[model samples]
Target: MNRSRKIVLFIAISIDGYIARPDGDISWLDDVQGEGDNGYSEFIQSVDTVVMGKKTYDDVLKLTNNQYPYEGKTSYIFTRKETSTNLNLVFTNENPAAFAEKLKSEEGSDIWLVGGADLLDSFMKEKLVDEYIITTAPIILGDGIPLFKANNPEIKLNQKSTRQYGEFVQYHYVHA
Candidate 1:
C-alpha cells in the first residue's frame, strides 16, 4: 500500500533532550509562556490520529482529570499489557512499525506520533517517521527519559521551519 500520510513526531523536550523527569514529571512545562496554546491548537487540528506508548497514555490520563486528551482523534496505545478498549482508544500489541505503516496507508490528514522513548525507537528502527516537530523548552533536566531511547540506525533530517514562543523554540524537520 502507498503510505501517503505523514507520520509526524510532535513532542516537547527539555533543552538537554529529555522528554520528562525520571519519575515522569513534566511540571517544568507549566512555566513556558506563550500567546495561547503555543501552536498546539493548529497542529492538533491537522492531525486525524495519534499513536503513543502505553506509558505516555497512562501519564496523560493521570494529568487530565481521567479523560482522554485527544478528543476526536483515533488514538492507539502501543502496549504488550492487556487493556480494555474505549471508543477512541485502541490498545495494541502489534509491532509499532507495521501498525504505523498500515495506518499511513489509510486516508488521513496526518498521524501524530505522540510519544514515550520506546515507541519512538521502534518507529525509528523501521524508518516509519516522515517528519519531526519538536519543541524545546528552556529548562534542562540533568537526567531523565531521553527523547530517542532505542539504539537505531542514524536518520537524516532536513530542517523545514522554526519558531520561537517565549522561552521555547519549535523546530520542524522532514526526513531526508
Candidate 2:
C-alpha cells in the first residue's frame, strides 16, 4: 500500500523556544548572521500543501502586500470565524485532526504545517506530524508564545540531521 504523505512542521523559533512574541511579533527573526536563502527556498519547494491556523494566515498576509504568498500551493486555514476564500486558499471549520488525516491520505508532495500554537497543539495531539524541521535563532525572548503550548504527552522523534548557519541551528527530526 502506498504510504500517506508526510506532515512536516517547518518553523523557526527563538533559542528559548518561542516562535513569536506575546503580540505575535516575529521581528526578532530578522537578525540572521548570514544572507541568502537559508535553505528555505529548497525546503518550500518540497511542499505541495500548507495547513495553518487563522492567526498564522493573518500574520503572513501582513507581510505580503495583502497578497497570498503560497499562490501555487494548496493552502488551508483552520478558522472558526467566517472567512472568504481566494485562489489557492480555503478556510475550513472542520476538525483539524480529521482534516489532517484526510489530507495525508491523499497523493501529494509533503504537507507543510505552518502554525500558531493552537494548530500545532491539535496536530501534535493527533500524532499527525511525521517530521519536524526546526531552526533556532540564537536569541531568547524572556516571555512569549511557546513553540508547543499544550501539555502534550511525550512524543518520540529520531534526529535525522543538524546543520548550523551562522548563529542559527537547524534540527531535522522524524517521528520515531
Candidate 3:
C-alpha cells in the first residue's frame, strides 16, 4: 500500500451541493440536529495540520468569536493579501498543488482541507485531494457557492463508507 500522508476534504455541504450561500454565509450549518459533534471531534483528532483559503480562516475566527479553533495545528491560509500572520497561522500564496504535494510528502498525519470555494477549486484542479468525507446538511439555499465550479476538473471517487448523523448523511469517498 502507498503509505504517505493524505489530504482529506472533510466538510459539511448543503443538500444541493452548496458549501455556503453567495455571500459566503455558512450560518445555515450552525445548528443541525446531529449526534455528539457529528464525528467532528474524532475526525479532527486525525490531523495535525489544516489548509484553507483566507476567507475560510477569517470565517472560522468570526464563528468562534475571534478565537482560532485550530489552536495546536499549523494552519496554512492561502491568500493574495498581505495579512498579518501570527502564531500557528502561515499565510501563503503558494501554488495549491505544489504546496499540497510538498506537505503530503512530509512525515505527518492526514491534513484537513478546511475550505471555502476557491481553495477547493484549486485542489480539485490538480486532483490533490486524496479523500472526501462530506456530510450533507438537509437545507438548501437554492443559489449559493457550489461544492464544485463549472468546468472543474473531473474526478472519480469510490464510496468507502456512509454515515448517518440525525438528518445529515455523511459519505466517505476515496479517489478512484
Indicate which candidate wins on lDDT.
3
Q: Sort every candidate by lDDT, greatest first.
A: 3, 1, 2
Cα lDDT of model 2 by residue, 87-153, tens digit:
7888998887889878987988999999988999988887888999999998989999999876786
For model 3, residues 48-86, the per-residue Cα lDDT tens digits are 999999889888899899989999998899999765568
Task: Indicate the TM-score of model 2.
Answer: 0.94
User: Which pairs clash in the backbone of model 2?
Assistant: none
lDDT of each: 0.89, 0.88, 0.90
| Residue 60 in model 3: lDDT | 89
**Superior candidate under lDDT, 1 versus 3:** 3
Which parts of model 1 have CA positions greater than 4 angstroms off?
A: 1-3
How well does each candidate superpose onto the true structure, as a TM-score? 0.94, 0.94, 0.94
- Each model's number of backbone clashes? 0, 0, 0
Residue pairs with colliding backbones in model 3 are none
